[model samples]
Target: MAPQTWLITGSSSGLGTAIAETVLRAGHKVIATARNPIKAAQENPQIEELGGQWLKLDVTSPDTTKTVKDAICQAGGSIDVVVNNAAYSLIGSIEDMTESEIETQFSTNVFGPVRVLKGVLPFMRAQKSGTVVNISSIAGLDGLPSCAMYAGSKFAVEGMSESLSKELKSFGIRVILVEPGLFRTKFFSTFVEPAAGLNQDYIGTPLGDTLQHFKDLDGKQNGDPIKAAQRILEVVTCTGLGVGTEDMLRLPLGPDCFDRFQTKCDALQENLTMMKKIAYSTSY
Candidate 1:
């Protein structure tokens, strides 16, 4: 297979760095982006050593579209794969979350990818081939207490990816959603924090428990970020486990994520079966 160029966001740590390393090792060119290039270099010191290019990209910034386009132009004017992986989880009860917090969550997690897509899709369309990988989470498949806002943002990504998959199918572009379960990464070590001010009314509820659960699971997560990155690379490159899955849409990593996906599908099936008559009546 010919070496392809990959552009990944949030490449400072966690899955982003893992993917960057994996792609570089496979002899592909990688353009890794982070909000702070200096800090990203500090976190993933091997990025430059591995021949991956680092660029400053803040998904929340209005200038992201231009930045991505410029980076692509600099990298020989062609991009084969794009991984939208920059996102932070905002854990808090819906009542405890302020409007500004909600907006920030969506702006970063939801609209961030939108900006990258705007910057790259036109080039992909002109070339008539490209893969778009959106890094989502298990929270996207099923909403959890204390993670409503984060889940809402992910759910929006899920919906948008589904729609984009259809819209771009004719153009030979594939859209994939990487829904991962808890993985050992800085995401838990540094990103997971409760709302600024906890609501006293909900202190003893599941919201509090969920927050504590994430803290306890920080360094103990069973999933491996490197392995996850490998699987993602294989899928994107159409090798190994991804050989026959060219049309597959969602790539759910980890047993935990698989089980959750099954549960959600089963519940949806049951609801459809039970509400078929009522739903049909409403149509008339």
Candidate 2:
């Protein structure tokens, strides 16, 4: 594949910034968007210095579609890859989270990317060639304690990406859902806490324990953002670097993600086997 232009969301820091830098290093053009373009550039001058354009974009805002479309036009009128990495972590139990909080979480994690997809689909369809990489999480594959809302949002991404991959295949567009484990990113620093009011009776259960564990592991995650970014780059380029197959639609990054994915698969298989008879009977 020739050098392609990439449009990445939330490129001010963490995996997004790493990805933007990696793409530039690979001699590709990049449009890195953040909520505050000026602050983003001040924080990561290498992005602009590497010939990548930085634009102010709020994925949750209704105006993002036009902003992205205009940016695409400015970037030579085509984007070969679109990486949706703009999302924040919302840590809370389903019962403790308010409707407003849950809606906000979904707005950023699910609807934001959906809007971007709708905004860019016309161009990608016109060109009949492009790749979409949705940044999901291991929690997307398995519902974990204390991360119900976050996981639910990612689950939406996973399902949408699966459907999109099929829908765009005939048009020569591909979709990759990158499920990553805990990485040393600003994600931890910016995690949204549960609502102000807490359930007193549920303070010391597994949910509480899980929340504590996450707090303790804040700055000590084992995954490296730069390496994860490089892997993502390979996947986007179809280069198979650190990937088992170039045609894979789902890429799980980090050892923790690999382990958790295997566990989830095994559990699913076991459940299916145990229910095979009942499932077959239902079909009849």
Candidate 3:
């Protein structure tokens, strides 16, 4: 495969860092962006040492979208792949989460990707070929208790990616939604907790139980970030990773993700079967 230039956001740690390293090792050019480039270099020196460039980018900043586009133009004429991997998890029940908290979550997870896409799409359109990889989660497909805010953000990304895939197909741009189940990354450690003023009545309910369950699953997740990164690279390069064909839109990373997706599909099929006659009669 020919070498391609990849621009990955939130490349300081976790899957982003792993993906950046994987791309560099594969002989591809990587432009890794983080909110604090200095800190990123301090944390992962291998990124610069291994031939990847670093850029300071906070996706929530008003000027960041234009800055990223300009930076890409200055570094290289065009980028072949754009990875929207910058996002953090916000865990809490719907009622427990404040409007501010929910807005901030959407700002980072949903609007951040939108900004990157808006900046990169013009270049991709002009180049006539490009790939967009959006990092989502299994929560996007099936909402879990106490994960309503995070799930809402991911669900938005999934829906947007679906629309973009069709919209940009004629321009030779492909959109890939990566729904990872539970990777052993800094995700749990850095996840945002619920705000103050908790309702005492709901402390021991199912939502509370779910919150505790998430805490217990933090360091015990079965998936590996490095392996997940390798698989993502393989999928983007069309290397036949046993998951699906090259044109597949959604790539679920872990075994847990695959199982959850299958269950969702089965449930959907069952519901459709039960409502087939009513739906058909209404359509006419």
Candidate 4:
């Protein structure tokens, strides 16, 4: 695989920063983006030391997306990868969350990547060689009760990525969805709350497991983000076609993710058998 240039959004901290650092350490140039350029720069000295470029971009903003794309195009003439990683969590049941909460989550997690993909698709097509990496969560494949907004947003991303892979294959653009499970990130700490009029007590029962996951993972998340980032880049840069889906599709990182994937697979197989046993009336 040839050395590539990576453009990663939300590079101020956590997974995005980890991705940028990994790319830089791999001797590839990176375009690190954040809503506040100065803050992002200040927060990531490692990236700065590595000479990675920084840009101001709020993924939820249409105008910013366009400008970031234009800037990227004007810079290295082409971008090898675009990692859409700017997103936040909204922890609440569907009814518990206000309209604004849902809108805000969708804006950042769903429409943000949609807007970035639109802006980059033309350039990637013209270049005929690029990768679009959408950072989704395990919640995307399996629903979590308290994370209705997050799950909905990630489900949108997963579906979009699945269709996009087929759609862009002819254009030489590969769409990979990164499914991370219980990574140690500030994402849980920053989750948006229900409206002021709403009661926080709703967070106790139905949302119990969801809240516990966050608390349990506070300092105990088994997912190492740095290694996760490097593994993702390695798979994306892998050579030849025979190695199969690892080259250009869903990449689930970490032990927790692996376990979840296996569990889902087993459950799916069991359910399929059960459905087969009851297919008589349904088949007609």
Candidate 5:
């Protein structure tokens, strides 16, 4: 296969760095973007050493979007892939979070990817080929307590990607969403913190324990970021888009994700069937 180009966001650490590394190791050119080029440079030295390019991108900035587009164009024209992976986690009860807090989270988690996609779409359409990989979470597919806000952000991405895949299908662009369970990444804890001034009055209950459990799982997560990166690279490089994607757009990568997704589907079906019994009684 011919060497491809990549535009990876949040390349300073965790999955973003791993994904960027995998592409570089595969002999591909990468345009890695991070909020802080200095920190990104320090953490991901291989990007410089391995011949990949790095740029400062706050993601939320309009100028950064234009710069990314310009970079992709200047560097050999078009990119083969664009990975939307720059996002933070917000862990708090819905009641504990302020309206502004949720808006801030959505701005980054949802609007950030939308901006990146808009920047890349023109080139992809002109070339008539490109792949977009969105890093959604398992919580997106199944509602989980204490993670409602984060899950809402991811679910919106998943929903948008589904429509976008079809919207760009005729233009020859493919959209793939990877829904991962808890991974031992920095965002699980230190990189993220409980919402400022959480409602401690509701502490010592199941909800509190549930929140703590998620935080505690940070270091103990079973999924490996490196392996996850490999999986994403493999899928995007597939010769053709997979089957039934229009109906079911995202892929659940982690075992926990898949099982939980399945359980949720089953429960939904059961409830629907039970509703049918009540609603169809006139037919008897």
Candidate 6:
């Protein structure tokens, strides 16, 4: 494959930073976007040192589209791949979550990617080739006890990506949903925002237990961000692990994500088999 230009969101740290570094090291041009490029570069000096260009972007803001277009213009009006990786988790039970918190979660996780896509699709459509990689979570496939809003946001991304894969195929645009399990990222530590206060009624329930589990699993997650980033690059470039299998819609990273994905498929299959009669009965 030829050297491609990659535009990645939230490239300050975690998976985004890893992906930017990996892409740059692979001899590709990377336009890494973050809320504060100067601060992000200060923290992760290797990004710019590796020749990754930093662009100021905040996915949650309406200005995201303009920033993306400006970056595209600055990059000679061409963008080959876009990785939508900017998101934060709002962990808490449905009953314990506030309206504001839910809005914030969707604005960042769901709408953020949409905003970026809107800006880049025109150029991609003209080029008739591109890839859109959405960084979702295993929670998107299976709702957990204490991850209502976060799961909801990822679920939206999953649905949108699936539909977009079909919608964009005719235009030579590929959509991939990267469903990752717990990776050793600040996702669990600095990025995971808990609800304002836990509801006393659910403190002794599974929701509380789930919250505790996240705390315990913070730094001990089994997935490696570096390997995950490499796999993503390979998939987008259609090389390495992506060769001979370019039709994959979802790339489940880590053994944990694979196991969970299989479980979800099995459960859905069993339910459909048992409920097919009821489903048909409802059809006119």
- Taken over the whole model, the C-alpha lDDT of each candidate is 0.91, 0.90, 0.90, 0.82, 0.83, 0.91
lDDT of 5 at 46: 89
Instruction: List candidate 2 segments past 4 Å from native.
Output: 240-244
- What lDDT tens digits, residue by residue, belong to model 1 across residues 1-284? 89899999999989999999999999999999998998888878888998998999999999999999999998988899999999998886777777888888899999999999999999899999999999999999999888888999999999999999999999889998999998888777775444566777777788878777777887898899999999999898889988988899999999999999999999999999999999889763
Cα lDDT for residue 25, candidate 5 = 93
RMSD of each: 1.2, 1.4, 1.6, 2.6, 3.1, 1.2
Clashes of each: 0, 0, 0, 0, 0, 0
- With a 3 Å backbone cut-off (N, CA, C), the pairs that clash in candidate 2 are none
Summarize candidate 6's per-residue lDDT along 125-181 as a digit string, tens digits: 999999999999999999888888889999999999999999999999999899999
The residue ranges of model 6 lying beyond 4 angstroms of the native Cα positions read: 191-195
What is residue 244's positional error in candidate 4, in angstroms?
5.8
In model 5, residue pairs whose N, Cα or C atoms come closer than 3 Å (at least 3 residues apart or on different chains), thus clashing, are none
What lDDT score is found at residue 70 in candidate 6? 90
User: What does candidate 3 score on TM?
Assistant: 0.95
- lDDT per residue for candidate 4 within 1-284, as digits (tens), equals 56788888889889999999998998898989888989888877889899798988888886965776787776766888999999988876677777887898999999998888777787899989898999998988877767778889999999999999999999999888999998777877777767753356764676865666665667667778887887777767763332556445888887777788889889999998888867765765
lDDT of 3: 0.90
Candidate 4, residue 60: the lDDT equals: 80
